[model samples]
Target chain A: MRRLISMLCLVGVVLFGACALGKVEISGLFMKQAGYQESDIRAMTEEFLKMRPDIDVKLSFVAYEELHDKIVVAAASGAGTYDVILLDCIWPAEFAEAGWLLDVTERLSEEDRADIFPEVLSAVTYRGRLYGMPWLNDWEYFFYNKKMLEAVGAKPPTYWTEVIDIARKLKAQNIVEYPIIDAWGQGEAVVIQWLQYVYAMGGTLFDEAGNPTMNEGKPLEALEFMVQHMDEGLFNPACIESFYEEVRRVFSAGQAAFGLNWTYMYNLANDPAESQIAGDAVIAVIPGFPDGRRSATCNGGMGLSILTSSQHPDEAWDYIQYLASKEVQKKYSQNALPIWKSLYDDPELIAQQPELIKVAKEQIHYIFDRPQVPWYSQLSLILSEELQAALTKAKTPKQAMDDAVSRTKEVMERYAQ
Target chain B: MHSKVPPTPSGMYPRGGLLRRRETAFAWALILPSFVFIGVIIFYPMGLSLRLSLFQVDLTRRGAGTPFVGLANYIDILKSGYFWSSVGRTAYFTVVSIAIEMVLGLFIALLLNEKFRGRSILRSLLLLPWALPITVDAIMWKWIFNANYGAFNALLQQLGLIEKYQPWLTRPWSAMHCVIAADVWKVTPLVALLLLAGLQTIPRELYEAAEVDGAGWFRSLWKITIPLLGPTMTVVLVLRTLDAFRVFDIVYVMTQGGPANATKVISFLTYQEAFKFLHFSRGAALSYLITLIVAVLALLYTRAMKRQIEY
Candidate 1:
């Protein structure tokens, strides 16, 4: 009994220590390319604390693939595991509908709201209620080897057919083994990359009534174009399992004349320490179709949101405001693409990231987003599988799209009931 | 002849009455905590899942209350091509991995049984693969199977074994087999270790007698070693079968059921249905179905081993 009493006292002391040391904990992904690394975020938190000494902030960084699942399980349990969550733009609708996020619509001033790009700003808004502050505005970009094109006396392709024709010439000259490489693995990466073409062809994944319609028309044409490139040896066969990082590696090694990847690759490809063809690499808009439509880029950005179960939501919101402020965003622009509209034109900012001002301005004009639904994850999986089937020649492009359409319809019906 | 009944420990205490009840109560007290632990950790969640499997529970849309849909989730799963394909993939993975692990493990176990130079060091070093965590092993194998700079293709090219590099994880069949190979490499050491313990328990005198009777090594192995190792092999088979059937980590890390869902096992599908899709009811039903399959496999193996041991 005496020992038990001492143990109880020890436990009480530890509990007291825990309570005394408590702070508002938040979590986000740590990707160097996205500029959300732990060291960078830690520095931001240190700066945040200097302004508000009364509030203590704890930051947790997980990998990009793991952050979403961690947030989902924690928020689903209403466990207050994190106060602030950095979310992919696609997740805002699902999380907001689940009542897992604290609405911040009225929290923003009119000027503050107007400064953000309308397209990016709307991604984190579900049904006219803002749940997140748009932070990193990342999207896909086309990278090409300028030296390779120049050697063949060719300019960068403005259309898909032009790209293929250039690829044939480059291959014939033995300039590079494969002319085009993309991150076309059997995952969401491939789906997002493929959507650029689908959108360029003026295709919608779903009808306005929220039913899949990728079986006919331009979507099928886009898919067939992708498979034909692989069959014709224009696309690197290794792309069947390559993700963005692998694509970057292939492009940086000067093994491919053209590559499709996210914005991060631009910085990496130009860095002499990271790339073999740093001097030769240049960025272009992803090519459109033969019909003279604008090339589309997928809406790929992330935001910071306050979880509904936060113990110190006001403090979390303050931290988000500071991070999303123009000054700090300007400071971090070297690491990531900032979402502020004014930053695009700011002389100092444009001088820092010249490619952002010159190319991304046009890239922003053709932004396309995935269908926003609670079942988006399932939808991506179903569609990617069918795409993979076509890529692997298990089914023709038409059959694969038809299968994807029917399976997606079934998923919709199930969710509807 | 009538057998004499043994007297009770205490003549003052009745054998068929209050004293026996006291003993029963004492036994219950000893086991009650363990029972409670199992109930909370295992049985309770199982019961909850069984209940949830009959409901339409989508936590994303919480305003839509979970309506009861008895057997609907099960029916949907049974009819779904995705679920059935995953089940087929899981069975193929389990059977192929177990066959490979058993044969490789048995050979290793047999080799280690013989006295050799540095036998003790070899025994400890053989466990290095199993000692590493599954995630670490899977990541290492992922690099090896990479298309361009992977050691696998590089080695094959250097050896003049193939004309060019193969994208091992891009095709459906190759991706499935690569995942299986990783699983086998990580777990074969464990099977060997378990069989090693069983091998040590076999009496040396039996081998000596077999040798005296002019039995060759192969003859003795076929006639004696295998016969005595039946129970152990059966145990290994059941355990490895169950483990392979519920495979997740290697597949998730390597291919993620990719190259057209060829590597997607039942567990991976269950995770997608429950976590990614947030279809908790369907996930629960799928999980219980998996549990039923595993339970049946375990029961059959144990029953077969019992009969074999009796003979």
Candidate 2:
């Protein structure tokens, strides 16, 4: 009886100690790659915990490819395993429609809404409802090898036509066997890369009623451009199986004069340890078609959302707000840029990454989003396969887009019920 | 003679009946744990999955609620062209991989059965591929088949087999074959080891008898070796076919059903249906189809085993 009393007393101590500390523990799920690095996130979490002693946040990371499925499984299980989750821009519609995230529209004040970039805020907004807070601000930018351009005595191309002319000249001079490279592998990467072209050509993927329109518009023309360049040997043949990393590798090795990748590539390509021709790489606004927009890029940003299942949503939101707070965001701006509109003009940030900031400001104006619908995942998968078929020359761009349209129609109809 | 009586239902002498009955009870007690294990781990989930399949359980449509759709999920799956194509792809992968693995396994088993120098070490080393985790094996093969810096391209180029590096996985047809090759490499060792055990069971006297009858090595192999290995060969075939039919991890890691969905097999399709799309009912229904097919194969296996050859 005495021993039992002592054991109960010990348990009592631990219980009371936890209660006395006023601890509210929350866990977050984040992607391991392409945004903030794991160490940076951990450091930021430590700082947040320091600032809010009552709240404890545990974090987990997964590859970006696995993030969507992981989030779905966790949310659908109805287990509050993660109080916070990182959400991609394209997922807001699907997630909001499913009611997996908290309705956070009323959480933001008018001042905060006006302070955040409208384009960046679109990362977390679905149908006028704000589901979360935008955090990672990213988009694709055009990367070029400056020495290769210098070899040909050419300037940065302002339009697709100029890019083609410079590519031809570089090819003729035998400076690089393939003057351009892209990530056209058989996955979401292909769809994003293709959309950049579509948006650059001043085309939208759907009608006002959201019907598919790829068969007769600039989508078809962009695909034709890609295929024609691949055939002409101006674009590398290996890109048919390459992802973003592959594009980075080929470009960093000086095997290609031009490449397209996300903001993460800008730092890595210029890092001497990561690249062979480190100093030769430069970033520019992605080129557009002569008869279309001046520039266009895809929005690759993500947001921080509170799961509906979270027991302590207030604490979760507090943690999220702290992570995206201007102070923390600026401190960790090495990987992803801040989402605040006011931060863009900050002299400190501009001085920290002068070249990247300059190009990013220009690229930010051209950011476009992929289709934001509840069936977007299925749509993206279909687009990836058809785009690959066209890229591999098994189907012409016209037939592939037509088939994609028909297939998307069937999928959309299935979801309509 | 007067003490003689009609036989009991058990047909046992009355004296030992109790003991035998106790032995039977003890036997059940020994296997009770396994029965409970199977009941909890296998049957419970299977029952739940069956219930799930008869309804429309899409989490993406949360407020709509899961409605009983009966066999609609199955019907829709059967009607889909993607499902049919995935089935065809799975069939191709299963047949081709099993064929290659069986042939290679039997040859290696024959070679291992021979008494030669360093044979023990070779046998031990042969188990390495089988012992490796499937993901590791798949990743290794992906690197080997990489387009830009793959060892395959380098070797082929040095051998003058091709003028330029070939994209082994970028093309649809080649991608499927590459996945099959990875599966074959990972599974052949277990098949060989099983066949080796079967080889060891055959008596040396039969080979001597064949030799006395003036049978050549080829003749003996065709008649003595293969005939005696029938049961083991059948076992290998059933095990490999069931395994190859549901191939998932290797294909997932290597190709991701890519290059125009060339390597997209049925299991990968089921994964996309359930997990990626959040359509649990359709996923459950697709899994039920696989279970049905596997059940048929298992029945055939049990029946074949019952007619096993005995010396």
Candidate 3:
């Protein structure tokens, strides 16, 4: 019996030692870019471990939809299974407010803080506390076929009305099957597109009292204008039912003359192997209102947040700082547009990719964040339903907006206290 | 088979009754573990779901105290337009899909029941759709219905059916039809298998006797095969109806209740409310409404089964 007990103890020690040697797992949802892959993360980890070999890191990738669902489940369970998590820019308020993230304000240095774009930093902060470090910066951009525009005797539109006129000309000349296409599906893309018009028309979804004012005159006017454009055949009738990939397919296939898409689509549209109109695609800022005021594009990207329940908070903080460093940012920006202002101004990289650098500079000032609330996801769904109702002609714009405002108010009240 | 014995010199009389009672108790003890397992695994979660449906709880709201709201959740669900719409949609889907599946599956089962060359190969081929995962099935249908470049449109255009490709999933009725078509493809095999089992159980003597009476093939099938298959058909319809009412994965993967909420079933709505919207209380309410619907259908099925069995 004594010998058997000693043998069991010896085996337990061996198992525990093996577990202690296991690598630290860091999981994230990476945006699929030109050269971003598991090897790039492995290379970064190896370099970081050269200075501190005591900590080991492993990486996991999730698709965008899966990532959102996984994070919500993980955070709600308070399992602390993920030591480091990648969160979208708009998620910090909800995640941080739920106490799922560690407050990282004191961990970051003032110099490191200054290195990030102000808009990006502000987006991830809530109630004057930094909860995450910005990793990437994304904004919507306009993609137009230069050859198609030239054939139709139209230049790239600089204003909303000019865009409609260009679409009309393109249609008349048969330069493109669909003159314009945007992601109007019941998803985040539609919300972003709606924000563009809302901001252009100087409207807001909420007031000081936190009541949704979407039914008011200005927002209604903007929505009506959007519906009218669809009615006038300035945009594809199917745009109201399209997801990102669908719109991307149309634009890439040269069926659409103009498209509003993300910065990452620039490379995809310009790749001759993937695109028929490779050399003809031109990247420009999303068109502004006719009154010379540029409309705002929804700012989207990911941030590094340490799980509050994490046992290895210190190590996780180290990883966050490493990811936020200027050197790492520059390296990552080669494939992804890092949120650091220093990397955006890097001369050598900019010389290689002038269009990307130009886009980064142009969109920086026009970036706007979505509503930061714990129930933002629910609000987004409600808004999408209302928008779809109006687009499908099932309900008048006023009726849909009124219903949406009432539903939002009710949901807010339910979660109030 | 034995009788009680007289007492011995040591006063140890035959105590067969007590001994038999003890043996019975020992046997029950041996089977108690399995009973405990079934109770814990199956009944416990069901009981928890029932209790949760009575409370006002939001999983996303960390540290919020859940209050006992009694039947408020259920009442709210009954009163809400969204809940009724989803319920109506689920019912419509369940009735349409089950009816179509039953008729097609019965026909296919009858075909396979006949002796034919390559019958075994055809049987195996029919099972392929059911054998594939729901996600794969959804993706296959999605590609088949792709607006610009899909096999369906290609076939149609080749036959000069239309001038341009039709957006099958972009239209309301077409989207629902597409989902139903995919569902029929996936579930018909199970229905056919069930009907095949029922067909096998019919006594060959009855068919021989019917032929002796000069009953034709169609008459034998109508009078003998279907009558004897009534119990099995009831079971199949009940099972299929329950499954069809709760369909989620395929629609979720394919359209996600899109094209203006034409395909929004109760399960999908419940999932969206619970996970996507993070309104756990509302989700619980919707789930209970689905349970109520399934229970009513089951009761009706039980009554029909009882009548058939009695006949």
Candidate 4:
């Protein structure tokens, strides 16, 4: 019995020593994706591990809707479980303000900073300090069925009014039931989609004093136009509760003539295996109003940030740096539009994803980042519900816009106090 | 299966006083672990939530210290239109769903308790829906309620019940009913099974006696069966009411209070305010209000149940 106990003690000591000598372990939480995108992220992790055998990464992925809440909950607990967190474009302000993220401004070298796009760099900056490394540069693009348009001999619209007119013509000609579908679900998607219209109509959500000014002028007109389309049955009724995936599925199934979706949908809709309208889908820049005002799409991109609670911030930063490197980004740019500006003109990349560079270049020019406010999630909730209320005729467009503005202003005031 | 034994004689417990005290202490010793466990897991969270409700804490706002607002959070929730609307929706959801579940569950339990062919198989089959995860059940129903090409619209179209596929979840009026229907489908089996257990406990001899007394089937059910099942009905109602009042998973997975915030229940609203909006203080206040409501409901249920049990 004594010998047995001694042997067991020796084994335990060896195990403890082995564990102590093991590589540094870091956990990352990211929003879940599918197909090549999911696999591409996995490959990136493997590559990072290969590059630094002294570090091991545990990546956890969740749905997009749950990612924010999970990050907030974990980060609010001060010392969270995750060492690294993938944050949405709008959440950096809230997370940085809460002091949950580590400031990495000094960590990034000048050359590394210069390699990334200025707009993408600005996205990760909070209150003049950089908190995250930009990874995925996402923005909306207009997608239309080539066959559906050709069936009616109609060209893709350059303006919002022409979109409506073409939609009416397509329906009258029995080419398609409705020509437009949007990710107008009562979530962040709706707010983003609605902002496109808001910006297209030459309306601004906030003024010079940072007050919600959506109650009148072009904002109200834009909202009324959206509702009028819904009333006219020119918009897909299902779109009232559909998100990007749903919109992608319906449009790729050739059920709709045109849709407003993110850049990622292009790959899905163009892949013959996943999409029914693989070759039939074509991309275009988002349309503006008939007044020839500049068009805008919500600038949506996710970045990797080290949590303040991370025990191994240096190791996490190493992996993040590897991910944000131009070489890896060039390889994975097809999965998520690369954040680095230099990769856009890479001959090999342009050959691989031809239209991506073209359309993304234009879309990036008119990118409208979500309000850079700390209470953006709450503001989005208020705006989206009010937008839905207007669309559903529960409240008039004017009333809905006015209510949204007042509620947002109230929130701002409460926060100020 | 044996006859009742008579009470022990006085000599059997000459030192009953000391023994009783020791037994009481032993019983407490056995229960002490569970008591502590419950106190930590349940009561501690409740106390913390109550305490937090008195303050103003928004971690999203920079330099926003947790101020001692003392009933101000509750006041703000009361004044907010969103909170009241959510409360109204939750109340409506609870009442309507409980009503539907009780009636359907009772009838199904009655039918299930009968000695019919395939009764055993049918009994096991009824548990399938309840056995599935709520998220799975909700997602399945979401697809069924889909606007473009859902099973419901397809079935209705085939039967010529409607001219076209209708978006059941888009409209406010139909959306609530759709949610209730999904919830009822998922939870009604548990209620039925509970009442079925109650029905099985009923003595066959009492029904035989009623028949000999010239009481019809309905008469015996009304006079004997239901009266004996009073305790069971109260348990079922209380459980169902509490569950329905705090309905979140189904509404969350299905509509997410969508189309126009038509199905935003208090619980989902509180979750949004707390986690999504990062307004933990307000969420706690709303949660406490819900807890108060539930406590009152439980008290009323127990009081009414006591009278029924006595009868």
Give the winner by lDDT. Answer: 2
Q: Residue B305 CA error for candidate 3 (Å)? A: 1.6
lDDT of 2 by residue, A245-364 (tens): 789888888889999998888888888998988998999999998899999999888889999999999999999999999999898888888988898799998889899888888888
DockQ (CA atoms), all models: 0.66, 0.57, 0.41, 0.76
Candidate 4: regions farther than 4 A off: A1-21, A33-36, B1-29, B209-219
State each candidate's chain A TM-score: 0.93, 0.93, 0.89, 0.95
Ranking of all predicted structures according to DockQ, beginning with the best and ending with the worst: 4, 1, 2, 3
TM-score of each: 0.94, 0.92, 0.90, 0.94
Docking verdict class for candidate 4: medium
Residue pairs with backbone overlap in model 4: none
Query: What is the clash tally of candidate 3?
Result: 0
lDDT of each: 0.85, 0.89, 0.79, 0.86
Measured with C-alpha atoms, the lDDT of residue A395 in candidate 3 is 80
Clashing residue pairs in all predictions, respectively, total 0, 0, 0, 0
DockQ-wise, the better of 1 and 2 is 1
- Tens digits of per-residue lDDT for model 4 on B11-103? 553344566566667878999999999999999999988888998888887586888999999998899888889989999999998889888
- Candidate 2 has which clashing residue pairs, if any? none
